[model samples]
Target: MAVVDVALAGRSYRVRVGAGLLDVAHCEAHAFIEPYGMRSIPIVADANAKRLLGERLQASFRSAGHAIDWYEVTPGEGSKSWAELERLTDWLLTRGITRSDHVFALGGGVVGDLVGFACAILKRGCGFVQLPTTLLAQVDSSVGGKTAINASAGKNLIGAFHQPSLVLADTSCLATLPPREMRAGLAEVFKYGLLGDAEFFARVDESSEAILACDDGVLETTIAHCVGMKARIVAEDERETKDARALLNLGHTFGHALEAETGFGDRLLHGEAVALGMVLAARFSARRDLISLADAENVADALARAGLPTEISALGLDCDGAALADHMRHDKKAGGGTIPFILLRKLGEAYVARDVSLADVAAFMDEQLQAH
Candidate 1:
């Protein structure tokens, strides 16, 4: 088992990453949840996750003499809406969840985000535990306190910074994840390396096959490394006060725009969008003479080899560059009417470019849209 501590001032927490950490026979898993000390614990999961792993998870908790009050939400980005938030908050209120009691979020990013936001506002903020079942959640979203839902303006536009009390990333649950989701999750896994760690990026580039195959050792090590990197960044910039935390959004600026264009649904998973977004960021960096064209191509090749779309042309969108760049104008990172781009200085080095012109981004999008 590997443990990474997110040392936020006066609000620190632990992210435990390992296989079978949520299994019934895992004594450590039991010990971790046992401390919450609730007889009837409230857990929120997506309908798909509940159907797949809910029985096993419930059994694990039941053995310890606890009953689970499970609440199920539809899977996907749509659940992160005002209506769903209202429903979840109402349910938590009916369960009599106090700030001291922890609500277990037992699914992927959607569940984690929705539940975390609900807990944040419930009775002036309550505690919650993240039992992330998806690879994306375990590696990135689950560790950060950036809980949010999409709004009419942009993705994660309506949200809060409420950290979880504990995050138990049981890699075993990933075994049940669909292949597409697993691939989508890889985009985030690679982002950690592309942002700060060149050595880690090299590892992913070399072992992309082993990772896609779910080699146990590779998977565990990869997840722990990503979590550790994220934990450190979150601890350093808990509220995005500095550029450090924003660095974590390496591919998000463009990725979120793609999501909005695709209607934030099954058409383009968040991670898949990020994969293409990162490729675009790399290529755009090269265009600005920040990095070599070979390096940008290498980034695109790595992701494309892993079955992610690296070209905007592949999306078959009906819109053009100006249309796509229009979506970015509403990005949450935009300030004073200027949208910042997370461009690559080189492979494994990303920086925020607040001075980027939206017109330049539009021209770049036009070029990518026509790329072969």
Candidate 2:
């Protein structure tokens, strides 16, 4: 088992990465969860996850003498909505959850975001544990404490920064993930390398096959490295008050717009959009002469080889560049009449550029959309 400490000043937590961390047969899952002091565990999982892993999870808790009161959420981005949030919060209230009682979010990013946000506002903030069952959640969303749901305005606009008490990423869960979902998660895996760790990026590129094959050693190591990088960044800037945390948004700005254009559904998974968004960021940086064209291609090549879309043109959107840029205007990051972009100075080097022109971005996107 590998542990990465997210050493937030007073509220530090550990992210445990390994196979069977969630299995009570190992006793580790129950041990870490027992201290929370809830006799009957309140767990919220997506419907699909419940169908697949729920029995095992329930048995694990049962073996530790804790009964589970499970809440099932519908799967997909739609679950991260106003209606769902209201429903989940009501359910948690009915369960009599207290600030001291930790709620367990046992599924992928959607389940985590929904439960985390519910815990954030439930009685003005409660504790929760992340049992992230997906690679994207394990390596990125689960550790950061950025809980959010989609609003009429934009994605994650309605959310909060409430860190979890603990995060258990069971690598064994990846075996059940669809190939597309796994590939989408790889975009985030690639982001860590592209934004700050060149060596990690190269390692991912080199071991892409093993990773796709779910090589346990490689997958666990990869997850730990990404979590370690995120832990350092979160500890440094937990509130995005500084540039360190903002660096984690390397491809999010552009990616969110693409997601918005696609209606935030299966049409483009969050990770897939980030993959293309990162490619666009690299290419845009090259256009601005911040990075070389060759470097931009290398970035695209890495993602493309991993089975992610590297071109905006491939999405087949009816709207043009200006429309996509308009979606970004509603982004939560937009302030002071301009949006900040996370552009590459070079591969493994990203910096915020607040001076970015939406019009210029529209034109650049237009060119790409027209490209074959």
Candidate 3:
């Protein structure tokens, strides 16, 4: 129902957000899918998404005379690996996928990242479309050009800057998501408000219940707003050459470490880790007098009310601050021994903080660990 454009000259694309957008036409599918004029479409999805949306999507595309060659991976962050990438590419090659064809990634962030990266390196470079099924993917990762697979050293350390040819965020697909996954997606939605719009945060705070319930209007507006903001930043600094796009990694520096420590499993979903990380970042900001304690508590409360973790201690991991901070040292944001954290100045005002000492981060994590 709404479109957000990421104008980057040659690489420009649009993010379409709406309920049942997978079947939408005129502005999107008509141009992208119709022009291919092929009977088959190459699609990659996680097991869960493929099971849930595969039949419906296949039927829709088939009705348009386009058959889908479905490729599936096990659904999880673990699928973002070298082995999976190699397996996926080999499958594509066996199927005769070429640079002239468009690949469709039809799942959450994991599927999007994996397929996007595969497309980026497949035959040097190929175009891909993102049919993101999760809220986290729709509002964040699906829009950004950051395609990656996890490395042994850390998460997202190996990848490329391949942008999607188109992003179709069908809110209808979200209806099949479990409560935990839905709540996790809400964390990224919350991040959009936290990082930019004070009024949006207030609206989200007031409408948390309705939003979680997936009211169509709320979902559309919420995802569209976040996508629009990201479109602006991606257009301004597509490669993160400046600090403009860096602000998008609001809690990622802390969150990625949590992900690495947990072995990137169901123990902590990426969005849940981001929820905890945002709280940590907020609390750390408050400790530095960058923001008030009240504001930080508000951030924690918002995420907690959405059924997300707000404290590292709650996970009961057998690790300490030193251990967690050590994992952070592998974060891509760090440079020359300094880790640049996305910290808040206030509710809706985030900045990159390069002055944070790892020792202090460890101490803070220690305090959090000991608190509960």
Candidate 4:
């Protein structure tokens, strides 16, 4: 197993990545819940994951002598809402879940975020474990402590910074993910390179095929590397108090806008929105003379090669730049009446800039839409 440690002073934890890790009794999973001395454990999972990987996790904890309760949330972004959160919390309460018990998030990013946020407020903050089953969750959402539920205003508008005690990413579970979901997850994996690490970007460029083919070795190595990068950053800045953690939101500002504009439905998956956001960020950097157009094209080309969406026009999205800009205003990074963006200086280097004018962003969005 490949282990990456997220050093958060008092809240440090380990992210274990490996194929078939989920089937090996999951001692780590059991320990995360048991260490808290929680009275009962709630395993929150998507319906599909419940059958695929959740069952194994349940059995693993059961064998470890812990009482396990299970809850199934519908799959997709629609599941992250106040209504769903309230319902899940009610179910937990009905099951006699106490503040002493930890909730186990047993699916992808959505599951992790929702469950983690629910645990954060339930009984003044219960603990939770992250058993991310998707690549996106494994590398991005699962590692970071940013847990949230979506509101009608925007994506992740109502959320909290609740860290998980353990993050277990079993590569084998990814095998059952749909092709589109897999491709969506790659957007986040690619972000680690685009935001910083040109060499990692090049490595991903070379290993794109191997990754898509789901080669166990390549997948394990890729996940470990991404997790390592995130762990170090999270350790340095558990919250976005400093710009250190904001770097992780390289393309998220724009990505979240796109997601919100589409109502966080299937119109564009989070990864698809992120992929396009990266392309837009790169292009905007070049348009502003911060980076060469060639570099921007390289970013787009790399995303294209990875089978990710490289343009907004192709998505058949109904909104225009003005609408997208409106959505940007609702982004979490929007503070003091300005949306902070993490723009690239070049491949493998990104900097947060609040000075980016909305007009400039709008013009770039218009150009991208026209190009498509």
RMSD of each: 1.7, 1.4, 1.5, 1.8
lDDT of 3 by residue, 195-263 (tens): 888889888778878877888898898899989999999999988888989998888888988888889
* Cα lDDT tens digits for candidate 1, 1-372: 888899988888888888877764224445445655755778899898889888888888888787789999999999999999999999989877777788889899999999999999999999888989898999999887999988987799999999998888888888888889999999999999999998899898788788778776888899999999988888888888778889988888888889998999999999999999899899889999999999999999889888988988989988888888998888877778777788888788888888888899899999888889
Candidate 3: worst-modelled 10 consecutive residues by lDDT: 23-32
Work out candidate 2's RMSD over C-alphas. Answer: 1.4
> Model 4, which residues run further than 4 Å from truth?
33-40, 65-67
Residue-by-residue lDDT tens digits, candidate 2, 1-372: 789999988899889998887774326555445754545678999888888888888888877777888899988999999999999999888877778788889899999999999999999999988999888999999998999999877899999999998898889988878899899998899999999989999999998878888888999999999999999999999989888989899889989999999999999999999998999999999999999999999998998899989988989999989999999999887788989899998788899899999999999999999987
Ten residues in sequence with the least summed lDDT for candidate 4: 30-39
Off by over 4 Å in 1: 24-39
Q: Model 3: clashing residue pairs?
A: none
Show the lowest summed lDDT stretch of 10 residues, model 2: 24-33
Pairs in clash, predicted candidate 4: 196-348, 197-348
Tell me the TM-score of model 3.
0.97
Against the true structure, candidate 1 reaches a TM-score of 0.96
Better of 1 and 2 by TM-score: 2
TM of each candidate vs. truth: 0.96, 0.97, 0.97, 0.95
Which TM-score value belongs to model 4?
Answer: 0.95
lDDT of 2 at 261: 91
Candidate lDDT values, in order: 0.87, 0.89, 0.88, 0.85
Which candidate leads in lDDT? 2
Model 3 misplacement above 4 A: 25-27, 34-39
Q: Considering summed lDDT, which 10 consecutive residues are worst modelled in model 1? A: 24-33
